[model samples]
Target chain A: MGEESKKELTLSVSAPSGTSKEDHASRRTFIKNLAIAGAVIGTNALVAKKVASVVLEKDPQRAYLEDVLPGDRVMMAREYVVMTDEEKKRLVKTLIENYKKRLG
Target chain B: MKREDKKTTIEKNIEGSTRRDFLKKTGSLSVAGLAGVATLMTGTKDAQARVTWAEWFQTNYRLMTEEEKREAIERLEKRYSEEYGKKVTVDGRPAQKNVLFGYALNIQKCIGCRRCVKACVKENNQSRHDPEIEWIRVIRMEKGKFSAEDMDKGYPSDYGIQVGGNAYKNAGVVLEGQHYYQPERVPEKDAFYFPIQCMQCEKPPCVKVCPVRTTYREPDGIVVIDYNWCIGCRMCMGACPYWARRFNWGEPNLPKEEMNPDTHYLGNRPRMKGVVEKCTFCLQRTRKGRYTACVEVCPVGARKFGNLLDPESEVRRILERKRVFRLRVDLNTFPKFFYFID
Candidate 1:
């Protein structure tokens, strides 16, 4: 078989039983993106997890919020770190929302 | 041939050098010329804009001689003026012998407006725009039992939330006792406010933990930091029970116009990235017999500051009269900041 057909056969074999072609393609895309993300990050897993948390959440202010609940505080500018493009997008969204709230 | 001998022979050539030699010489010369031009073009105009060895190796505030202090202050003023593009005065204002600072807050009166937070950011040259830093943290707590003891116990209660919260309360609705509380209007019906800053503790744990002695209590009883000498070890920040100290993780930004021109050597002076800073009772203002920015900006008359040594001072009167308590009194930090009720 040609390279393309061989790749298709491998993907089909990897897919769970009864999964559709669309689902298989999406799974392949997801895995590819995940791999790329893993490669681009400079820090260890723990810090990446923290960096992800910062992107996804902005409440009760800081990561060390022992007092503020996980979601109530706004992100302070001081906690910024280098981030990937996707992470940067999420951070921008979080910051705008935080600005709207005008958190001290 | 030895490379050195060949180069020497080429230089001594009476018939002049070859095309290769001319090309090499010209290329290197042009590259060096370009570098020189680039440096000149990109240079900051202020001749003294950079930190000098004298400034870098300056003695600590407490240890500096009178002459040394004058030189240090002059260097700081010139450098800061260059950085900000405006004339700024950096003065070494000593605490008065008869003065011992103290602070009191009427908790009930503090509407949790956080005005004090803003005033502090402006008065002291705390970082603004990027990596925002605040010296004061106002924790909002539900009208329930909470203290340093509860904080030590861990979790929701440690943060001032009662376990098995009001059954009628909506799910994920219970929130309290956190350092960052943003309510639409402060004094949220069933909650109260606790503004925390450097307590200017008589026996500050933050001062004790500084391995470099960068932080110390002034003779006037106000704890201050020599930002220049701090090694950014964060030991003082860790030791502060009140969470008063802030670290500059990156280069801090403060615009020229927003820069507070008036500065105290150990207080509101513009700090570089990587130093630890906290409220010094607004040393620039306080040492000169003025109240802290928080005290003056307080619209409700909730914040009071004065000389603790004066028998008739407002702080002394409050101590004598009000039902006052210091956070974590059990630790015996002897913090000068007090929370009181009328």
Candidate 2:
């Protein structure tokens, strides 16, 4: 028997009683593509979701600023306790002034 | 003789009346004093003071109401300020509201000099007693072989010696040859010092396991636990693959002299007993546009922390340039933590 005819005989024997050639080919292609798509989309989605959430919500520079202050530097920058009304106003004014300066 | 006897009788009667009066006053005072003492004892052993491990297991650490969280923050801030003599602002702003933090470490460059570890302890108000509250731990591991067991054999002998013979002292040692091995060190190379902390995983198991939703991933990939909301259930600790989370067994042993007063609502303020804590990526510092304490204190430029979204950020550049790998990639935790071996 020729090789092609022998392959055809094997397929016919293995095939379900009524399965079509087109159906088998399409199923094979679908499974292959589905796997490829799953891998590509799965990883991309995971990384993108995390990055997007962080970028959308967090101010990276601000977070850095809050963390970088040395012990001595923080002491020098002395966060004033808002105890008395006068102290509260002073602190508020200082913060506003600093913000304005930075914006400028 | 009769007159004298009358006088003596009168004196005896007066003494008996005085004794009765004294007894009545003493009886009233004793009752009042006992009541006061009882109240004082109850105050010490109030509902807030009775913390048990079983109670902790049942209590949800994450499901605190806003009011409860605020009260906790207030208490933390007060404690810090009192101890440190500096004003600490416990910002209760939502993680997405104002601040963001990210972290990175280069395994190739870290020399295992535990400066970052000490710095984190000091900066984060970590308990002197436990020293495990802050979000950093240096894990030594072997190259080619990834498991801890492979590195244990080489660990003891590698102390204080650089990877190359004493020749490369003071110069930046790049892993050029196979002979380079980490010496006996707290953090050693050959064995890479993987400083593992909150991976802030995209799908944080800590957040999922939290019964009260006290611990949640912020909009910026930072996972935070509301200490007030946390009923000290150590579910977060159990769920953490990196072993980054810690539970306060007692009131945080903060000495008045060593507290950092510049606090953030979601970041390092003095923590209370019975709350689980991990690294917030130094949110207080990061929120204000600064580097994390560990990153800043690293004598070698091993630690890099920045926005992964920013292509220009140091973290992004390292990720792009190096063959970086996250811990436990098999688990699909999607940890923000990364490491590179040269």
Candidate 3:
């Protein structure tokens, strides 16, 4: 909405003396029209602005490895939902071997 | 006339000799005799009226000056030691001097045993005549229903029912929902026991409410009442939400033999009539760098106590690790005492 009209509408709605039938009806109608027009144009304009900004922005995820600290460890493997007996045994064997190598 | 004159002359001569004798004794008798009479009178009054300073002034603790308090304490200690057959110091030095204490309890673990209640009475030098006078009272409650209103209603009733000129067991009308005290059996299915005592609140209401400022919070968070200073207003008793305070309606009826002698300044020194008193968290024992009687006697290891200020203290550790709760968080009293369900 135009700034002048928006100010006028706000004043009309909040004015203490605006309890008369005519004043109340007019204020209600103005508010309803303002809400509808603002919703349609506001959503599209905001979305278009956001899309343009996103296209211009750099990807943050690409530098994930570089962001990690020296002592920090990362989970490299996928989290297993269901594992077979053989897979479990193999995982245990790998862990044991890693522990022994680290210790030695 | 001549005979009478002769008799008069003889009497005069005898009186003259007596006067001479009295004159001779007057120098020796005047000062010495007066001094002797005055000394005798003063001694008799002193012996006859042997009223203590406290009795003479009708002074409660708050009125006593430092010198007066010291003299009173000395007299009490001497009297108690003589009566109790030990060197019983009725008032030890203030607990701030190399003495600290802390207390904790697991509300979930307490089984409404009431053993702690009895133990505290013995340990704290409470009057046996009225066991209710001292340190602790274990309140039995059901879980999720620990309000005071419920417990008051649930207290058992005795309806004296007689049969055949004598009352028999279960003979009369049995009241439904009445429960008797049983040492072994738990009070409720989901029973929770909260042993209420002086919180030793960081901002103690009792200390604040005292008109004479007779009660005060020590540096180590123990609230102490000067029994001599308290004017028996019972304002502290009213201010305490936990009902931990008690008034000495009469001189404490303790047997001389059973009284605990190792009294701290803030702890169980025998209180005179017309004053308020409560748990000092066993300041007599604990403030001397010892554990509270209740804490040491807990069978389930439910109670824990330590310095909250020290990072390594058990109380600090519990506050850090456990979900501990005080009785009424809304009051903003800042109670040092805490209860943990687990």
Candidate 4:
């Protein structure tokens, strides 16, 4: 029965009347290679997803932080501390310039 | 499986059961259910299984008794500590006596650096991403022109609403202020900055509009919201003239390492979704005699905060000496926040 089924499979795969044997063989090989490549790609995607989940589990907040825009991430900026004398003077000078133009 | 056989089976079971037997069965089921619940309450350290259950039923912070407040704080501390992998304290400090808090911002001195805005986010433990929440908003306004052409164009000359400014130019600092201007350095050429936050109004419109009565002014003159009792109706957001209130549209995205462990119950504790939060004058720190984060971080000493009642306090000094004004004074919100010029 198995041999009979194999014979049927071969018949189904057989090229049409006008097709060359070389073209048919190459087409079969191409179909087989495509299926194998697809399986590998799918497996890799699944494995990568699993690894991401494990990483996310280790630091749950990383998932939440991942979606944050670079501009919105205040944590990455230099933390504001009490002003130094030089910094305060520079700011005052800038303010004076701004107000002078407004007044004029 | 037939309808008649099913009815017969149910009727026989009902008829066969004696009153004593029924009572025994029900009582045993009740005991089993109670046991299962008790196990769930005590057997797991999961915050959802334990803390959240109690938190949902807890009374408002304003209504909770001393012992109840302590228990609530303890529960919060435990949950936060577990979640953040560090010790977290939720301060439940009451308002200090004879201490009405007030804030003053020097508009002229402000350079539009946005340091105070960022500082407030860090100190308040506001949502870090998705919906990036900051209590303070710095508005940059261009210096308006008072050209003669604008004067004639705005009045009966045009058929519009007849508001002051015309198509040619505006009279003063026009209402058109840019909120998201990114400059290489602050105090950009001809722009002035106006920073605004919760005014902690003596008669806050937000408090008046809140249906749940979850937000109210404390004895220390700070307007605060009891987040748990807030229904997230967003009526407060609409009522506020300063646009001070923020609604948590989604679950707040606060990271663990970035989370400020020291938090006030009403001020900066990590908030859940479906709650309204705003500036509380850093009650967790202010009540303990520390300045609000914005005041501390202002680069030009542009921000000042203190007890309004004290004559020597910086806020009172500003009111006494500086040319000061509150925003929307005609609205009669009677804001405790004041803007001043040096």
Candidate 5:
């Protein structure tokens, strides 16, 4: 496979009519430079898009601590899980009833 | 045949193969395998294939050498910083000499506000959403006792024998307690709060039952779990009398903005799925001569923490002056946490 690829490369280098070795080298360099420039511009554009999104963020606004209701704060728990008021009330009732039964 | 010619003849006779080709192929294969392993070991950002591969092979925190411990902490810090979108520090501070930590809670004064529970979750960086994890749980117990006025009241049901009861209510009856109790406001007229957390037992049953030996009591009397070493067998959860251990039932959902960047390796650091975590007495703060988050945030000053070895410490004073008792003393766990009634 290495020999075949080397033979193909030699054939291509020799087949170009009126194209000097230096001309071929210069053309290869130009293509390489063009690729590098394209890559840089592409990367910059992507980065700019990301920065724009961050700068002009469309995320939903969050409530300030003072604005949030006490009841809501009690429910939110700073992301911790908490039972709903109804669930808690139900459980409390059951607990009181159990105690009442024990008393009886 | 001559020896050289015989060797040449044997090589020619072997169908579709040569000695050089075999060596070359095997050599290239070994080199490729080594390069692949090197890439994984050195790490790459492709697929964000970071320290996880190396992390799986790490030894238990107790067994790691100083250098290994530093590297592990650095690895974790990098991973957490990348994951949380902030600089995260994973502290590896060991227990201090001659400092046995103790905690005392004024059960009578707790208002059932559960602020300590929330503060603990915030400071410890517990899972936020799905498997919401809070180290402290405040239990509401309705105040009930015998009354001299209720001597002839019958039972609510007809079957059971009648004990002492008031006309409309019962006497000498205490409810088991409620963990899901949430009121419009706390400090109800008929209720008192009892908050429970890891007692940091002197002889932790959790440590005894842990199949992987991942959880252990530190010299400072703070029981901690090496989350990485835990096999998620949950034997320790069953063995704990306090019901303090919480299992990560699913992947933890800690948001980047809410994540606590300051973390201790065995204490309040963000945990992975399938590991059992519990209160570590907030060793991250406590070991640094600061109070636990619960103690710091207790509105009623009900929670107290200090060095048990120091007689001047608040915990020691509480133990000496206040009517203090450890929970489940019959279990012989010798928990460092004390409940005091003023």
Candidate 6:
């Protein structure tokens, strides 16, 4: 496919903007198209990674820190993933509880 | 923030688990894969032997075996030597057995010269880039009228000189990032200087908040960070009430001619973009029985540092003989740093 067509394909098939059955269906379609696009562009790993990073950054799992972290430097650390207060607390608490239970 | 009195806090919560299970408990196992992939993709074999699964998965310093500690130091030394094009020592210097570090600054003797701040940047290998990094911030405040709000104005307390907008011949001072800089003279008659850095708290909030356990207190009671192990998460920065931690927004720019070769694994090693850094009382020098860069450079000899445990040490004498106070006493951080008057 031509460069312009590939760009159009990416835009048209992007992950849905909202939660709905239709959006889920479109999201699946987008993932499939994304696979094809990666295969086409993966010949140049650097270019593919650059494009992939832009997509990866939009992932909800990644946005957890940037969303709730209260600081002047909001969105500055979007590129780096940091565990949130809630996540760290939950993880450590659960781990410790399990450890205590196992020991007892 | 985890209170100092809290028993069985996160730091010791994994005591019941085995090493392998503890690894899983910390969720390092799940994240290890991500860390491994990250190291491989972004920094594969950087500086000879830096980027590897083995290095990425290495346990925390406190948990590491003697052999592991040796290897860790070796890796850091090798990596830094290659990066700086010279022999760099990354010491794994443990705190002295009987020594507990403490600092006392004589606010009366302080001239607000900011000489300590300059020395600190060079000693700590701080980033001298667009988002300039320095671990020390000297706050010049009015003697009696001390409101943190006045810090932003950077003006003479009595003058009411509005910086930038007012048409005064000398429109106050132009502070960069709330850090007082280049006022021609320090200790403006009615002003007193407070230079702040890591307090090396007996119960450091930063250490408690670190999810990866990359920062910790040494036996001799100095707080330090492992740059290699730090995941570039700024959680510690947020936890620090003093704002002691600094993050490199981009690759640090250290000129070859200007770079101080003396370094420690937990202290002054050259840092990449993202990792958090803070003062370690200049562990590279402190371990060798030398004073910190701040203490050595203070023009007025206002800074005092020594083994807090030694009855004869200057710091101990200051604690006994001088009128001293700590920052944020209500927080009960029990900061090693003290402000004193002669």
| Model 4 C-alpha lDDT per residue in residues A5-46, reported as the tens digit of each score | 977765565434224434544655675577579668967987
Q: What does DockQ come to for candidate 3? A: 0.00
TM-score of the candidate numbered 6?
A: 0.63
What tens-digit string does per-residue lDDT give for candidate 3 at A1-104? 69889778666654543344345456556755765786678679879989986776433222221221110111111111222345334433443343345344
Q: On residues B78-155, what C-alpha lDDT tens digit does candidate 1 reach at each position? A: 888888888899989787866777888998798888899999999998778546788888766555443444443434
Candidate 1, B149: how far from true, in Å?
29
Locate the minimum summed-lDDT window of 10 residues in model 6 chain B. Answer: B165-174
lDDT of 5 by residue, B94-179 (tens): 99876778888997889989999899999999888666677777766556556556656655556665544654443212234255
Can you write out model 6's per-residue Cα lDDT over B84-119, one digit (the tens) per residue? 788888777777666678898997898888889889
Task: Name the lDDT of candidate 3.
Answer: 0.60
Per-residue error (Å), model 1, residue B114: 0.6
Range of the 10 consecutive residues with the lowest summed lDDT in candidate 4 chain B? B168-177
What C-alpha lDDT, on a 0 to 100 scale, does residue B134 get in candidate 4? Answer: 73
Q: Compute the DockQ of candidate 6.
A: 0.02
Point out the higher-scoring one by TM-score: 3 or 6: 6
* lDDT of model 5, residue A94: 45
Q: Candidate 5 local accuracy as lDDT?
A: 0.73
Where does candidate 6 stray beyond 4 Å?
Answer: A1-104, B1-54, B145-178
> Who is ahead in lDDT, 2 or 5?
5
Q: What C-alpha lDDT do the candidate models reach, one value each?
A: 0.71, 0.60, 0.60, 0.73, 0.73, 0.69
Q: Candidate 2: TM of chain A? A: 0.32
The local lDDT score (0 to 100) that residue B299 gets in candidate 2 is 87
Fnat of each prediction, in sequence: 0.00, 0.00, 0.00, 0.00, 0.00, 0.00
Residue range B19-109, candidate 2, lDDT tens digits:
5665676678679768865554332433322322223333333455776666656655655555466776777665433222345677778
* Candidate 4 ranges with C-alpha deviation above 4 Å: A1-104, B1-45, B145-177
- Deviation from native of the Cα of residue A18 in model 6, angstroms: 42
In angstroms, the error of model 2 at B82 is 3.6
